[model samples]
Target: MPDIERKFKCSSVPYPPIISCIALLISMRAITWIGFIIWLVIRLIIYFIYGRKHSIVQNESKD
Candidate 1:
C-alpha cells in the first residue's frame, strides 16, 4: 500500500515546480502579473482538490 502511495506522491511533487517555473517564465516575457496570479490560483485549486486527499492525515485515517 505504501509503495502504491509513493508512486502517486512522487508524481505530484514535480508538477507544482514545473508549473510555477513555466508561469514565471511566461510572466517575465509578457510583463504581466496576471499570468502569475492565474498560476497561483490554479495551484491553490489543485491543492484543495488533490492535495487534501493525499495528505498524511488522510492516509492515517484510512489505516
Candidate 2:
C-alpha cells in the first residue's frame, strides 16, 4: 500500500516557480486582450457593411 503522507510536506514557495506562474498569467491576459480587440474590430466592420447595404436598399426602394 502506498503511504499517504502529508501533502503539505513539500509545499514550499520557490522564487522561480512563483515568477513563472506570474509570467504565465500575464501572457494569458495579454492573449485574451488581443483576441477581444480582434473580435471587436471584425464585428464593427461587419456591422458597418451591413448598415450601409441596408440603407442603400431602402433608398432604392423609396425612389
Give lDDT per model, in order.
Answer: 0.80, 0.84
Candidate 2 local lDDT, 11-42, one digit each (tens): 56587799998887777877797998999999
lDDT of 1 by residue, 1-63 (tens): 644545333558888999999987776855357787899999999989897888999989999
Provide the TM-score for each candidate, comma-separated: 0.40, 0.46
Top candidate when judged by TM-score against the true structure: 2
Residue 14, model 2: lDDT of 89
- Clash tally, candidates in order: 0, 0
